[model samples]
Target: MQYLVLAVLVGCVALLLAVLALRFGWRLRWLLGWLKGNVLLALLAAAVMLGLAAWDLQNFTEIEPRAATVGTLSFNKVGNQQYEAVLTGPQGNETVRIAGDLWELEVEVLRWHGLPGALGLVDGYRLHRLLGRYLALEQQHDSSANGRELLPNLHSTPPWRDLWAWIDNIEAHRLLEADAFEVRFIPLTDGAQFSLELGPTGLTPVPLNPAATAAMKRFN
Candidate 1:
């Protein structure tokens, strides 16, 4: 929206300049040539602004601070300390075999505060990954519990290329802050089901079944 406004303002200024040059008739040919060049420049500027607006619209959602369910997960035990996990979310259902005592979900969040927040640049988040985790340090290091990628290359993708980092670098005042990463984890019990939520602060897991509730109780 801001980009659109800027584009319109640039076009209006260019039209006004052309009209003024013709009305004054000061070095008519020279001023006309200058206006021609500036007109081309103005067109290029408008095009760039429009492109940015379109990109922003496509990539971002209206930032909401309230908690929202982003996905759900269920587990079935397959072997010792191993489970077949099914995750259903915006991207769809994905199944991965994991070996661990707990399941962890990680997300990347972009937050805007103060003037930017007031201007409607609120918050945006991307699912980072889902991984198996161990409570013990030795098990975490030695166990074969490699996690699965929930969302592919979220940080490196074009147009999204770490937008938070770019904003932090360019903005003199700290109006935006990206959480290095937010994580939520729960015990991985057989037949356990949970709904994952993305809130203003971070990710949270809500148990959905008796198995899940019991697992959480033991974990807590």
Candidate 2:
């Protein structure tokens, strides 16, 4: 929808420019000749802008500064310091058994700067992954520890590529300004439920039930 609005605005601006050039052509004949010669070029430029808008729509999502819930998670204890976590998000419901004292969720973020930022292209994000974590320093480094993945492996198909990766590479080389990878940690408790929120800066986990709140209080 944002892209559609931008395309409409660009078309209106192009039309206005043409109208003004024609209106002033009576006084300056060169302006009229230039407009005639550049008609094809103007059309090409408009087409390019529209193509960019469409590509952006597929690659990014416009996010607001305020926090918004993107997903929910609930856990059921399956073993000592292990749980069967149920997560509901953009990819639908997923269940994974993880072992640890807490769980970590990570997201990939892309922020536009300069003119694109001013033109209402706000921050965009994608669900990266979730992993179980341990509080003990030694357990964290233990290779055999059961710190399982909590999200499925979804691969991009043809025509749907990782544009965010390309943008991040450019930003790393000082060619552009972009933000990526925001992580949040949450304690895992039996029957605890949490809502994952995305804000301007990063991801936050909000307790949605008494079990979750109590767990957060103890964990903190």
Candidate 3:
């Protein structure tokens, strides 16, 4: 929706520029001739802008920033050096096998662009990285290493890099420590933010709110 609005806006601006150029006739003759000679370049530029606008509208989702939840972290110690971290909601039960003793949830900031962003219509964040830490393994490799920062040489996918470039936006990554037998997430505008801690008896949702469940849905 936002992208659709943006495409329309760009088109309108282009139309306005044409009108102005035409209205100024003699005053803008050189500009008009130049435009005619460089028609292909003009069209190419317009096409690129429209394509980006469409892509943005399709990829980006708008949500209530203050109430939005970004991502969740849940894990259970399965063995001496192994743990299972549940991703997203409980229904999926999608788990990742980790050889680490801890986990980190990283978030990337995303904000609206053009007119919508200027008017504050769209602004939020998105999940960039979610990684499990193997503290024991790291200690074995680097004796001086402390788990204050993320493991080095972390690389992102080409599509993700391209999308970031297309949007020309800067992403902020924040690390949150995850505890064993519990799930917690930060309150981000675009991703999942929920807290669920496993107790002695079993697992249960924290805060007991419908939004908690809905947050997982939005985050996914």
Best by the lDDT measure:
1
lDDT tens string, model 2, 1-220? 9999999999999999989987877577786778887997899988976675456445445566798887898899999988988878765777777777877766666666667767776677666556777788787667245434344432131223455555565625332355655444567799999888877877777888999999888768
TM-score winner: 2
Candidate 2 error regions (>4 Å): 1-60, 144-161, 171-178, 181-185
Tens digits of lDDT, candidate 1, 1-220: 9999999999999999989977888668887799999999999998976675455434433335688888898999999888988887665677778767887776666677788989977677655566777788787766644333232432234544445445546645467676645544578899999898777766778899999999889878
lDDT of residue 179 for candidate 3: 17
Per-model TM-score on C-alpha atoms:
0.59, 0.61, 0.41
Ranking by TM-score: 2, 1, 3
TM-score of 1: 0.59
Candidate number that wins on lDDT, 1 or 3:
1
Candidate models: Cα lDDT each: 0.71, 0.70, 0.45
1 or 2, greater by TM-score: 2
Model 1 alpha-carbon drift over 4 Å, by segment: 1-63, 144-173
> Candidate 2: minimum summed lDDT over ten consecutive residues — where?
151-160
Which ten contiguous residues of candidate 3 have the minimum total lDDT? 173-182
What is the C-alpha lDDT profile of model 3 across 142-171, one tens digit per residue? 523654333321113244333444444434
Error of 3 at 15 (Å): 40
